[model samples]
Structure formats: structure tokens, C-alpha cells
Target: MGHVPTRLLSHPCATRSPPMKERKAIESWLTDMDGVLVHEGEPVPGAPEFVNRMKESGKPFLILTNNSIYTPRDLQARLYRMGFDVDENSIWTAALATAQFLADQRPGGTAYVIGEAGLTTAMHAAGYILTEFEPDYVVLGETRTYSFEAITKAIRLISAGSRFICTNPDATGPSNEGLLPAAGSVAAMISQATGVKPYFVGKPNPMMMRSALNAIGAHSETTAMIGDRMDTDVLCGLEAGLETILVLTGISSRLESETYPYRPSRIINSVADLIDEI
Candidate 1:
């Protein structure tokens, strides 16, 4: 969240340097916190070192994620508790992105959200009205408990031509036990019930980039999207016109990379490798 640019001189033998040529010009980075930075509430391998490097360099970066269950404050505390010191404003969730989009598109419209209070609060704060009475849109995300009443209400609203807005399309996230169902699971069911596709506002969608750039004052040429998932993170950056780096840590393995639809600008073993490269 902090935006402080400090000067650093590259070695004389370095491949490139300022004034002579652009040294990649990576001014801002957008990264996923979970899986990439931490796994099971613990900092992932080399995460601490990578973050420390950023701090030392005074580089501007933000942690972005599709998980909408927690607020910025919640994530900030959790990361601090796990020994990763990050500013709360550096975290951007799908919920916040979706809410911001909705506010700009249809301010004060009613939303039938299928997520947690974090999402609801964001929507309301953004001038969106939360209601089950003939909602203007159906906002979908992960829900721990999908009650019969909730399904019925959403289906009823969907049948009435309420626009569907999905947070992210992730089907699962890693856990200590195993992979658990993610926000996209609920989005899939709702799409099936209403026979309507949703306007996704998470990864692979350019709106995420729009919001992230607005927050950090970065442009496509000067920003890098570093992530583990090619389908979402890498694709989002490519589609949004930003440089992308794929890391082999988290959800994507080497086998998965070969089958990815698009290729990343660069590939690294982890965020730590990014520190070495950039």
C-alpha cells in the first residue's frame, strides 16, 4: 500500500540500466497472497525473503486475491499473525473489485449476494442496496452454507432477468487437509439454475487490472502480474495488457504449464526467483 520510490543502482556489468535502456521497468506488481505467499497460515517457502526484498527496494506492490470471505483488515491481521508484515491497503479482494464495478455501473441498485458479510458490507458501502425483494443483480461467490431458502430466492431472482455477477471462477483452493471447493463452485451452480452466465470480475477478467492499476498508479508497461495459476493470473495479466510472470509454486505444476492456453512473458520457480531476476 505504501508508495515510496527509492533509487538503486544496478551493477556496472548488469545486462541493462536506467538512462541507457529500460531495465524491464517493473514499477508495480500485483500478486496473490494465498498459496503464493502463505500456505495453511504459514509463509510459503521464500515468501518472507521476497517481501523483504520489495521492502528494501521500496517498490510498490499489492496483494490481490479472488477470495471474498475476508476484509482487508482481516487479511492484514492474519498475515501479520503468520509473520508476513503487510499493509491492509495493499490487499484487494474480489469482493471489493466487484463492489467497485457495481457501484460504477449501477449505483444504488439492489444486489442478491450469495457470499459473506465482507462482500455485503462492501456492496452496501459502495451505495448498493442489499435485498431479496426483486434484486437488480445476483452477485455470486463462495458460501459455507447454501440453504434451500437461499437457493430458491436466487433462482427466483435469476428467472426474472437479474444480471449474474460472479466474483471468480476458481473451483478449488488448497488447504491443510486437501483441496476445498472455492467461489466458482457456487457460481457454477447458480449459472446452471438460472440458465444465465455471469459477468466475472476476478482473474482472467480485465476489470481486476483496471482496479489494481487505479489503486497503484501503474500502467501496462510498468507493471507485472506474478502468480501461480496460468489460467487465471497469467491470463488476466495478458488480457489486461500487462507483463506476466508464472511461478511454479502453488496450484500450477510443470505438467499444467504445458497445457495452459497462453504463455507467460517469463517463468520462475517462485516469487523468490522474481527477486533475483528483477
Candidate 2:
């Protein structure tokens, strides 16, 4: 990914403002998962309390993630193990957003998918059929293991007529071994083969943020997005017309974030700093 053009961010579809003078009290919260709350399966400092505060306040909130490999229930269980009592409904993934977008575009559509249970299950729940036969879409999502045969099939289907969709634009994912090839990497190969780039429905696209907001009946004016990355998290929040908070606990550093065309509404050390905000 490259630096976003300033004009593109200024499109009238959504509002992206410079740092605010005084803002409305945040009545709703949308926070990123990996960096803002947990990191490498462990809860970030003050993350659990922040989550508890959200729950206790009875305010609308959702934990967002680009990882489309695990279902919301699966993630909720994982968070519970780490002492964050987040409900499944309070978790949002790129898989859910992609599925929601597809369902809205073409109800009961058929798709050829290359992903794990998270993506497959969302597609199923959205009334989408999984097939190799003339699918309406060739959906790409995160998988623990990528199959050559599936990639070939996706390429062929896309070339033949299926529209291509990817869960996220992240080119790589973290692992115990360091980094691993992710959906975006595979999507690139498929796009190269078919000469058709995929439409991504994850962070930075604003669809993910908007879907979460809609799920909680949140209006942008009263909501705030807490994230750790300037690219995905902050961009998505800003485009969705939410106040954006950038934390330093993840991929983006204070210095690194300065390079982006737009700045987050505020920058803090971590979610710990926002506990009082709740």
C-alpha cells in the first residue's frame, strides 16, 4: 500500500477532519483488536480494564480486527481466556464486514471462497452458496494454510466472470515464527493472473468501521475509533467520520504516523490511556 492521496481522503462520501478543537463526548467506541487490546495472545496493559469499562458503562462498543481466520465466538473465547470479557457480538472481523457487504450487494449469492471457518461461516450465514460452479464472487480471506489448487480455481473463476473480493488488504500476518503470507499476498497473485484487482472490505476501506457502527446503532458524531495503525485503523475511522485515536502499542509509532497524509485525532501510549475516557 502507498500513501493515500489527500484529495481521495477528502471525498464527500465521509468526513475527515484535522485535529479537533473541542469534540462531543464519545458515546460509542470502536477499537482495534491486536494492537489496542491484545498483542500476541496476551492482553495489553489496561486493555482488560478498558474492555470492562466499556461493558460496565453500557455504551456501544466493538472490538475490531483484520484477522478473518477466527469466528467471533472463537475470538470471544480467546479473549475470555486472557480475562477480557467481551461478548461475541461485541467483536467485529473483516470476514463479517465482507460477508455483510456481499449480502447487501447480492442476496443469496454464490461464491468460491479460499479461507477458514470464519470466512466460510459468515458466507453461509449471509445465505451465500460455496461452489466451484459459476460463482458470483471469488472471495479471498485469511487461512492458516493456503492451497495451490484453490488459488488456481479462484484465478480461473475470476477470469471467467466472477467478481473478486478480499477480506482485507493486509499483505502479511504475524506468527510465532515471525510473519506469514496472508490473503492479500495470495489475492495479488490471483489478480496478477486474472488482471483484476480485488475489492477489499476491511480496515482503511471504511466499510468495516461503518458496518460496526451500524451494528451498534452508532452515529459517527458520537463515536470514537481507537486503533494502533495509521494506515488501516486511523484511516478507516477518519473516513467513517469518527474521532480517531492512535496508540503506540502496535505497528505504528508516533514518528512513523507523522508520515501519513492525515493525522489521528489524538495519539496516546495505549488503550490504558483511554480507560478514563470510557
Which one is best on TM-score?
2
Worst 10 residues of 1 by lDDT: 4-13
Clashing pairs in 2: none
Best by lDDT: 2
TM-score of each: 0.86, 0.92
What TM-score does candidate 2 get on C-alpha atoms? 0.92
Residue lDDT tens for model 1, 25-61:
7888888877688866778888877877777777778
